[model samples]
Target: MAIALTTLVAEAQRYLNADSISDYCPNGLQVEGRPNVQRLVTGVTASQALIDAAIEAEADVILVHHGYFWKGEDPCVTGMKQRRLKALLANDISVLAYHLPLDVHPDVGNNVQLAAQLGITVEGPLNPDNPRTVGLVGSLDEPQSARDFARRVHQVLGREPLLVEGQQMIRRIGWCTGGGQGYIDEAVAAGVDLYLTGEASEQTFHSAQENGISFIAAGHHATERYGVQALGEYLAKRFAIEHIFIDCANPI
Candidate 1:
């Protein structure tokens, strides 16, 4: 069954509550396409590979967690940007994106999905004072050594995580998906035994070591894979539309 493109976008916005979040890019309908959508493609990022896959699948809409037009980025539609837009326009496929909203959604959010993958029993937000913190603080159902936890992360995310060992056992921990190393400060403030995020910085290592909190830099694409898939499944169920999650591999 095909649903109007605008209707689909509105439904996504409602489900994600995209309007409430302060995001770097537009939250919905980044590129308009055909009036109706049947097959939908969901992915971590709207890269050329994903777009090509969408075209191959004959998808009318591409839903993603990372889209273009980021804040402070050069807005000129040239080179790579021109190519991506050209393909979308040429094929009449809409690209819809939600960044923070997708990360923070309690049900299908990136952090919560990662929590399930890592076997975490979430206690609350990583930022205690903020009710809507993007990162989460939680506990393992059973505590394990930092090394073992890294193994677990590898098992779940299909990528070996970079481990900065801290406590012998990790019970309570903090995590955010996709280049969220900056939130290590918040994790430290929350007094968790460890912090896990994608893509660690040089200073993150120093801070984690000094503060006695273990750190894990799981692959950015790996940790962020779930939210888009979860949201895609939900949309598929909700609208009776076909949704396929295209995993375009990214190492950082």
Candidate 2:
């Protein structure tokens, strides 16, 4: 049976727990597509390629991490913006986006799921004040060499992580999925032996070497793939609708 756009929007809202704050982009139903959606396509970024793929697949709705109307994006709907939205709007495909909420959701969150897969037991959020903080602090159940731990991360994530080993062993570690190298200081203050994140800044090498904390840069797209995929599967099981994850290979 096909699912109504309204029902799918509500389902995503409940799944992400996004009722508390003013989100930057329209959280659910950014662009109205078909009235009923039999297939829901999920992806990290709603790039033109993804939108075209979804349209070709006859997806009635698109779910993504990065949607339109980001904070710093231009307000004027022109160029690529107009093209992307026009395609979805023209086809009546609903767009549902979950950014930080998906990153922090306990069970299906990117950080939490990545930590669990890497054999790390998460203690709590790295940033206490912000509910949307994407970083988490955790401890490895059994301490291992930094190289061995990195290997395990590679095996679980299917990508070789760029690591800067520090002076200490890796019993405790902090991690944030998706280009969160800024949280290294938070990890250091939390007294974790290592910090793992997607993408690294030029200064990150200095930070790890000087701050006496190990740092690893796992691929951003690689690390963030888990949460949305898990969420998609959950949505499929919970609702009688089609859900497909479209992977856009991103090396950065």
Candidate 3:
């Protein structure tokens, strides 16, 4: 049974609350494709390779984490940007993107998903006052060693996490699933024993050591894969729409 593109877009927008957040790409339907979508493809980024793959698969719509037209990005579509859009538009493939909303969505968010894998039960948002904070604070079911936690992160994310273990138990944890090293201060202020994020800057090492908080740098793309997968599963169950997750390998 094929679902109408309009219906899918409407449901996705409502589910993600796309209209409420200030995001890079326009939340829903970046490019219009067939009115009915039988097959949907999802990926981390709407890059040239992903678009080409979607086209080859005859995907009616493509969903991604990083779409076109970010806040500080080069607006002039010249090089890679131009090529990405060209492929999608040429193939008449609809592009739907969710950024912060995808990251912060309680049930299907990146942080929440990553925490779930780490055996942490979420207590609440990292910043309780800030409704838009895309990080979670939680406690491990039982206090595990910092080394054990780091190993678990590696097992789940398929990469050895860059880690700085503080002299503390691994009970209280804070996590942000993408490039969120900037949120170290918030996690520290919240009094969490450990903080985990995707990418680590050089300054993060200093912050982890000086702040006396354990830090783990799981790969950015690796940590993020779960949210969209959960979202795709949700869409499949709710709408009976066929979904496929396309992984474009990104080390960073």
Candidate 4:
């Protein structure tokens, strides 16, 4: 029912191929805790709410997609950072996080998981030339109007995405899970009928409009919910330990 914290971390690092992928933050074991883990908590982000929820749940380890110590962030552990680290240290709950590794994993990656949810049959990477590209190109089972595809996105993600309708029906589609509107140009180059991502920038509209490709900006949190859950389930099954996914909802 329980596994060593080191063992769990090693398994996760191996399973996700964490070390091979480059990321903004460290890939695994952001916070050290007890030697053994019986209950594992997983979430999209390691926010204060999630930490509190994990403490209440009596979790021994917290695995997440987003964790602390990002590049360019202030090195000083003050304010919100201090509080988050304090709670984790006090409770002896380990934190393991994966950013790009979770995004690009072929089996449990965010992009692949989103495609499965939206009924998109993945054809290939959004950018074949770039090994680091996290977006993907796929196709709907049938060609649907931009509005119809947007409706499907809303239904699946439980949030109404911002839609910029294009002139054509949505068949060949491209998407990246979080803050990937920057990849719209790559999607356009791939010849997708529509492009979807979590957050859109101002220039994204111009790119979509000029290129005649529909665009959808689903909430970043909503779009990325699945990968961590999938990874949690996989870990629980693999280690025969308890795993709980806590969603501390973020609108953005």
Clash pairs detected, candidate 1: none
Q: Order the candidates by TM-score, highest first — what do you get?
A: 4, 1, 3, 2
Candidate 4 lDDT over residue span 181-246, tens digit each: 989999999999999999999999999999999999998999999999999999999989999999
TM-score of each: 0.98, 0.93, 0.95, 0.99
lDDT of 3 by residue, 120-158 (tens): 899998999877667989898788778999999888778
Candidate 3 Cα misplacement greater than 4 A, ranges: none
Ranking of predictions according to lDDT: 4, 1, 3, 2
Cα error, residue 212 of model 1, in Å, equals 0.9
- Which runs of model 4 end up more than 4 angstroms from their true locations? none
In order, candidate lDDTs are 0.92, 0.84, 0.86, 0.93
Task: List the candidate 2 regions with Cα displacement exceeding 4 Å.
Answer: 129-132
For residues 191-217, write the lDDT of model 1, one tens digit per residue. 899999999899999999999989999
lDDT of 4 at 34: 96
TM-score of 1: 0.98
Better of 1 and 4 by lDDT: 4
Residue 55 lDDT (model 4): 98
What tens digits encode model 2's per-residue C-alpha lDDT throughout 30-98?
Answer: 777778878989998898988999989989888887787888888998999999988888887778888
